[model samples]
Target chain A: MEELSKKELVLKQAKLAINFGVGVIAFASIWVFQFTIFPDFFKPEPTIVEFIPDSTEPESVSYFELDSADIENGIHVPTGLIVDDGCQDVMVTCGACHSLDLVTQNRATRDGWKEIIVWMQETQKLWDLGEKEVVILDYLAKNYAPENTGRRKNIENIEWYNL
Target chain B: MSKKDSRRTFLSKSAIATLAAIVGSKVVFAENFPKELEPVGLQPDEVKVKIPGKSDQLKILNSKPLSAETPPHLLDDEVTPAHLMFVRNNGIPPEEVDVQKWTLTIDGESVVKPMTFGIKELMDNFDHYSYNLTIECGGNGRAEFNPPAKGNQWGLGGVACTKWTGVRLKDVLNKVGIKDDAVYIGYYGADTHLSGDPDKVVISRGVPIKKALEDETLIAWAMNDQAIPVMNGYPLRLVCGGWPASTSGKWLTRISVRDKEHDGPKMEGQSYRVPKFPVPPGTKVPDDQMKIIESMPVKSIITYPKTGAIIPKGGSFEVRGHAWAGDLKVKKMEISIDFGVTWKTCELKDPINRLAWQRWKINVKLPEFGYYEIWARATDEKGVAQPMVLPGWNPKGYLNNASHRIGVRQG
Candidate 1:
């Protein structure tokens, strides 16, 4: 057994006193919190909010909905698809399922349009177009065909305006 | 082109215009006049009927196939509220879903015994568990790509961390008895295709069998202890945390185990896949070379103080946000005031469970602030830190986990 010198014995007593004090403080804090702070009884009921929609508001215009009426009435907006006989077939056959944006967003070639049609028929459950496919193809290829095959040009430099 | 028309400015440069611009505002418009009548100046979904049970702040990207996103500030909550969760739909959610009649059929090349478990049966038989999991769109930051990719232009808001309650997908797969040859698992949803073809599915995508069997991958029926919002796959959904949300099919109807990769809509043909190698922005990679996006990259969003925030004169404020790594733990969270010149470590906390996003906070002390962009970057356990700038871009614009930054003005 190692015997402690007088100085070592005093230092060990101080370390023991600090440890005991810390332990007592920690235990007391835990006891105080468990009794006062963490009570389990008499919990409040949870409130769920019910949603109410305004019944009287008028319909706001959507960009998609805004031009749809003009397109349906055969009044050509200078911006939209070319108004020809084939436009009707394209509208009814293609627009029946998805939005026209799907068509207008693309700039594909004749073969590309045909390829999309084939994909639709094979996967999207489009009925066989037979010969009507030719007319629809013509409209899409002529109007929406590739003017550019890539994405929008990046704006590299900005010209500052003089105020 | 006419000489005068080509030289003309968009808004007239009158004395009043010049004075007004110089007096208070620093904004300026460029030199082309738009000819078309701008459609109703009202914001999207402003005049239209509000989507029931969604935050008014959710930015609607498209209406027909209905896509919307949460602004980052709205996602400051620790667990994303149901109403604020971003909605990215492939097709219309099936109308009139009956939870009582809901059934999940398990079959395909890899199952020993094909089985159909009713929703009730699933709830009663399996041990239920809840986990806080993160799901982010594969194309979360598509808007930043130069020569912009043509898809939903999402910013940083297409993600959420939510507590999902459900049965373990592995437990159910075990009941069905997976064959040793099982290579992949795919799910089909009841969402109607835009073509409204009863026969055609909207999207059917899945993950590798190993990912499918993880503890956090769930056949979830409830979110935040309540029935999920109808727009978010109400009765049943497969919650594959840490993967692209597209892989976690909404309104799940069937589970198919495949001996090979499941060939479903959007699973191939560059839908959720990216280039096998890094491609320059706008480079169109061939379909055969593209690979499906699996576990998402390490990402973080500073969801406090909002962008364009004005800091108080003190030059001190606490910055807090969420950080997540796909199928891994976040090893470190850092903030850069000098745009990657130097970074300050934040107090990062561990996630409550595997696949949950970890929260981090820091007392940001700005050196001197005029206009500073506080950038948040997260590093995963594998030591892969987020790229400070836009990452390698592919045609579809997927998996852009760049460091997120917000502008703050300080004196």
Candidate 2:
């Protein structure tokens, strides 16, 4: 036990000596850096020489991409319009000239919509709809007919939250 | 501790950590906890439809001929930022507009002295002036029409205020001498029709001779000290303050002075016209009776706290907003929390200049924690106050200057 204690004292002294040696070395290194490397901070040249590293790696860069789902869904992209059950031809023809919202948002009777078509042809320079006019009008009037798309429901009609 | 003891403790802790990581990976991924750590900043959210040169927050009402508006909350800035200004286009903007080659022609039947001036000539010859003017779409409240108006169905967001810097349109008109019989002035723009027809003009609207001569009316080249955004007309546009924004033609290339009222394409057939008399909802009025809309009505919008703002139970709400009347001044403004039954007058400030919207604010300490709506109304210099409910319905659903009601909650 006495021999073990003596060995422990030797180990403790060694640890102390090692710590003192490390402190001295650290001080010397800092002093050397101040005179050698640190002088560059006061140089006439810009200290931040090419601070931005060359971007050769793809991992560092990012880009925004239009998701194919966004285009098919017709929400993010402006041309993404409400797709009715069977209006593929309508989508192609109408979307080619102008937005489909002009057709969907306008709540008109068959005649009202027809008048619009005539106006578009007369002044707005829309080409003749041919036989497809009737079919497209049928789809529009059926789906987006004049319903109650006015202002928000009155405060009385909305769901109430208790105080 | 002894060295061996410390090493054993470290090894055991390291083993426990590795075991925990193995289990945690499975649990976190399965339970959606890993989604929290997954980077979201790199990808764009699908909800917002980003428009070029516009805030992504803007609601796009139509894509073709691109019509969009800023929600009242988003339009809370005193002088609306040029980028944030709403877009109301009748045709696609001209592409690759070379500012150096841009020129404006002044001619028509009533112009005795027809003149053409390059943009540089306009800048060098005339004095430049800047004014913060409010420009609200005629169909701003069209969505509120009961029968559902046939046009863009715009909400209250289709309005904004901005500073336009340019020479007075009146000064330009005087330079190009107007005949004694000059009744109105029409403007032509570089924008082509939707059909790609070279012959067709997108929109050629005009104000009366008196309105055209106003000091605020400008042949604007700069908006907020910057070349105007392409959506708001890049090189030049007419700034017809206090009138329907449609009258403020964009992409201006030519001005035609007319002996009679300007009979431009959109000037006729109830495009920007209201009924001669107050009509019932959904009344089919004739084109002759549809009078041209001169000035907009007095209106106020609550810009602060947004509509769905929630305050702490004991907190008092501070309400702020802007008010403007077409061609006149907003004299008094009031806020009603109890549905116009009792109204507390808000401290309304005078406009910075004529045609600029005046800002106002009030602090309300509500009695209870509950759902509440703050209704704001304004009276014009002519003693005209906004109708609390929907105003008289027009065929095209123009000018429904009803009180702006912002619904809020206290909890």
Q: lDDT of candidate 2 vs native?
A: 0.76
Clashing pairs in 1: A60-B47
- lDDT of each candidate versus the true structure: 0.76, 0.76
Candidate 1: which stretches are off by over 4 Å?
A1-96, A99-163, B1-49
Where does candidate 2 clash, by residue pair? A74-A80
DockQ of predictions, in order shown: 0.02, 0.09
Interface RMSD of 2: 18.8
Model 2 scores a TM of: 0.76
Error of 2 at B69 (Å): 0.2
| Candidate 1 per-residue C-alpha lDDT over B190-291 given as tens digits, one digit per residue, 9 for 90 to 100 | 876665344567899999999999999999999989898888888899999999999998998899999999999999887899888887765757899999
